[model samples]
Target: MATFAQDDDGVVVIIGSGAGGGTLANALAKQKIRSVVLEAGKRHSLEDIENDEWAMFKKISWLDKRQAAGGWHLTENNPTLPAWIVKGVGGSTVHWAGIALRFRDFEFRMQSINGDIAGANLLDWPVTLEEMAPWYEKAEKHMGVTGPSTGMAYHPWHNSFKVLATGAKRVGYKEILSGPMAINTEPYDERAACQQLGFCMQGCKMGAKWSTLYTDIPRAEASGYCEVRPQSMVLRIEHDAKGRANAVVYADASGTIQRQKARVVCVAGNSIESPRLLLNSASAMFPDGLANSSGQVGRNYMTHTTAGIFAVMPKPVNMHRGTTCAGVISDESYNDPSRGFVGGYRLEILALGLPFLSAFLDPTPKGWGKQFTSRMEKYNHMSGVWLCGEDLPLENNRITLHDSEKDQYGLPIPVVTKSDHPMDAAMRKHGVAATARCYEAAGATDIIELPPYPASHNMGTNRMSAKARDGVVNKWGQSHDIPNLFVSDGSQFTTSGGQNPTLTIVALALRQAEQIGRLLNERAI
Candidate 1:
């Protein structure tokens, strides 16, 4: 692995090594640009991945102390853990289920299509889908997505998908199939095919999933232009007198504060921490926060309006015998205000292990009664679907620093406050109804409508806009206030599109890498 000195002022310092930061580091390395990636978790090898859900979760999840507020049920249900992000070198990519998807055309221009929806912070992305098409293709190829675009075979349908597809067809749905997934269907990219272990969210033990821990990060190191430093938690980004980002201060693994000088800094610490880092970096020049001139740095936070629906089949379905979220039904994933919702959502096949089922079955205090035990007993006959919907951005739904609470590093902990827009509730109701009808059509005995679980798709905090006053970053994800600063994560999303954000996050990182590289060559920063 490559190593760089702390005072390497020419190196680009990127915080977090997730889908965006990890991909950006490798992309920059490909352009012969040096970067130092700071990951705030312990490094783990393929041998460390486990097939057990709870075990792997304990091993990789970002178990940091965070608070949740506002009207979102998570405050009461999961107050301390509102988001389900990972820590380690690969970030949440290590725990992702590899469902790669792209946003629809109208999704990029939500405000244009919806036309001034009240109480919603609808804004069109500075970059269009047409502009991102090539990047999306590159991302698909790089991730080895199993789809027609890559000429890669999709995984064989497991019994869980069969049940979901059967129900979907019965309910008059057409686009029901195992959708584009980053998990390999056959040997490709020097990675093995998925071993049908059914614990994809836990981490792929067979190296079949496209995680930066085994892919882009190593490739970047091999290029000898990128250095990934794990167990380094960035505390703040520092800028010069002219307001250009110059260095990052982080705590090393030994709890020693170290400063790494840089020409450019990219923050990709997931949506929550990404903005928290900026807010914590407030200074005399940018008193509110770095690059927070518009006061939008931590506003418009979104996690896909989501819900889980599990149905008990008359016969044994054994939904947990295969991949976690490979099956998808996209018939409803289009804009149609006639459905009482401005945006749309997709119903993807989902399965949880017994442990998670027991917990998420009911998050209430007295949720472990006979009813819960009875539901666990019917686990073998259960089939489930997760609703991935577009969560409308509200200016008030944001991440703010806690009043007094501090973390291990003494930085104020972030309080994620979110509330469901009326549209969100309408869309979720529509999804639950449609999903229940599908299950009923397939002769399901009973159905369980699970509330939103800990957020898996975190997006939209430091979003992009054509005008600097409208957002924190520009189309290239460069900070409007700090020329040398950038947001290389899902936090740069203009709107929460109805798709798994990993693909778009990688595409944006790839695109940003090119822009940053060009700027470096031109000495624009």
Candidate 2:
């Protein structure tokens, strides 16, 4: 409920109130640093959340104008929308699957582990796992993840996970467990425990899942130093004559354009929109676009290599009875180039309702037939596993501004261009085959391979680098070209590791907030 003046230049102006922005704002508030979060979507409440998947998707998913090109599997299925990001005050955290995982040591050093791979723009993270461990611990405790860091036990194996585990154990999978999840196994952070409601993709109504919508944003506002302005879509970042970003132009809730002064500006609008906003903020000094000195602002885009395997059991598995994504098979999650690829992958057990499955069963022209209907009719007998792996960054696979296409705000629409690397193909092939083996071992009558879905774990767009020539941001997510501008989101990932990204994003934001606080106290803006 706290509000800062529009002309207040002493406050930090953070764009997008999601995992990154929301966490940063709250962390900074603890240090008594004021911030104003401008979110481009409505402020949703627990009352508005529902268990209906498609209905909730309509309410929260970002359906804005975006063009997807290249061989991305979602091109044929979801051409206009390539990323399944959420738009609301809490950003995509409102729709996340509650999977919390930290990057392994080898993953943070992708360049060193996989050397000189052709067509791969690999780089070691300027910050290492050793440096991030404490931050990761803090994030886990803060989010109440089911882990020892939080003094909580992991979630019990759900039916879908049980089905997958039955076959996985028989197939020699060792590292199998109900992995760390952000959902509360027991009520720890004032949030209620999960009641085994199936539609986790739909926003959690029980508040068991960690979401900035009900956690960080409210706590930051309660501190009386932060204000969240919903439906404020930023158009451009304006820099002073000294080339320091000092303000942003945005359309308010009523469609009125307004300028908000800032001491610092942080962009956390996910990957695609974050780069698009920076690219749209071109000025005479930054003609190539703001903070694009290395031409890396929108380059090196990566969405984790992903796919799925659905198995039809002879008996009713009743997969859709518990949390959607709690089981993980991480036997392959290591630096094993011997597996026909450089990086590694993990097989995560997940279940979807019939509605979502039918749409993604086969997204071709002749997708629906009696055969498809027959498979869907036995929903209770089906169990699925999602395959995800490290997607090596490719400089040409990027987000670009369309020359002629414009949205309701008249800003050029973003075009996402992607082509799978050879490594990506090898990883996907191995992952799919390994996952199918698990189901086939578990007495699966039939198996179906599903192509990659839209980009959910998007990363590496405005990536971090040790030097200014290589990327847009530095170790602290500060813009290399503009000192006061920062990217506080997954877009600052130097490389995409084989894990869910939300936990890492939150940890990085918490770490960045400490640095920003020290700099603010030293008057180093």
Candidate 3:
């Protein structure tokens, strides 16, 4: 509700309103600093959120023009739809499943613990897990995560979770339980308890799930220090003669160009768009891109090596009656190269509606015959799990600008290219075998291994490093080349761990806010 002048050069301008940007806005507002948030999509309230997957996805997903390349199957099955990020006021937070998790200690030091792996661009994070523990605690409490930290009870196990737990136990897996989640169990932070409507990915209409749309953004606006401008698509960042970012040019709802000056600019537009924006902002001084002195702005892209396993039970399981990701089996989520892979993965309970199952169960052109129809007929008898594993980053797996393609705004479209490392294949194969065994232990009659879906966990495009020569950002997510520029999203990840990225993104944003507040107080920007 508070508005600043277009030419006001004192307010911090944040480029997205998802977990990182939204949390950063509220954190800075709590410090009595003003900020302006420019979101590229329309603002949708709880009333506007639908419980239908296809409807809500069409309503909020970022369906902009993008191309897929490399040896990944998605390049052939879904060439134009590489990633599945949202483009609304709350960004992908509105569509997240609320599986809040922290990275393991070894995951933070991948290069050191795993040594040099072939064809992988591994690096230890500039900040370690021990240093991030306090921030993770703060983020968990702030988001009202239901776990031991908040003393909030976890949601009662649904039938599907019961099935998963039984299978996991029979398969000799120990660490089986409903992991930490951001969805409310008992009423907390003025939100209602989850109704278990089984539509979390469609957007939590009951206000039980933590989303910036109903949490951080509203809180920041209530403090009278943050102004959220939706339907404003950023074109490029403008830098002053001294190479400090000073302004941002974006297109308004009416397709009119508007410029907002800023003292600091944080790019939190997810991994793909964040890197694409920097690459599009090239100038005479920085021909490669702004803050891309190391030419790593759009390299080392990672989306968790993922696969979906669905099993057919003799009895009706009604898997789609609870949260999208009901529980997790984390016994295998540790590093053990003896398992034929450098990294590990988690088997999380997943249930997709019939519509999504039909589309993603087998994405091949000839997959719609009798075999696929038979699987759909057993919808109520199906139980599923999604394998989320650490995918090693490669220098060639990246986001690049198209040579000739352009969007409606005359900006070059982004082309996401990814190829599987041998490690990724090995981990995915191990996960499939483990998941099938668990289902078989539970008396599953048939099992099917689904290929990777459109990427939901995008990371590692503008990563952080201890030395400026290795990455684009520093320990604080501040650009190594541009002092006033920052990356407040998952794009700053040094390596993607075997966990959902929302928790770490929020934690890092809180840490970045503290550093930014200190820099502001000392007039160091």
What is candidate 3's lDDT per residue for 194-251, written digit by digit as tens? 8889999858999899999999999999999999999999999999999999999999
- Candidate 2 per-residue C-alpha lDDT over 466-499 given as tens digits, one digit per residue, 9 for 90 to 100: 9899999999999999989999999999999999
Q: How far in Å is the alpha carbon of 478 misplaced in model 2?
A: 0.7
List per-prediction Cα lDDT, in the order shown. Answer: 0.93, 0.91, 0.93
lDDT of 1 at 381: 96
The lDDT of model 3 is 0.93
User: Which candidate has the top score in lDDT?
Assistant: 3
Q: TM-score for model 1?
A: 0.99
Per-residue lDDT of 142-190 in model 1, one digit per residue for the tens? 9999997678898899998898899889979999879699999889899
lDDT of 3 at 525: 99
TM-score of 2: 0.99
Q: Which order, best to worst by lDDT? A: 3, 1, 2
lDDT of 2 at 417: 90
Off by over 4 Å in 3: none
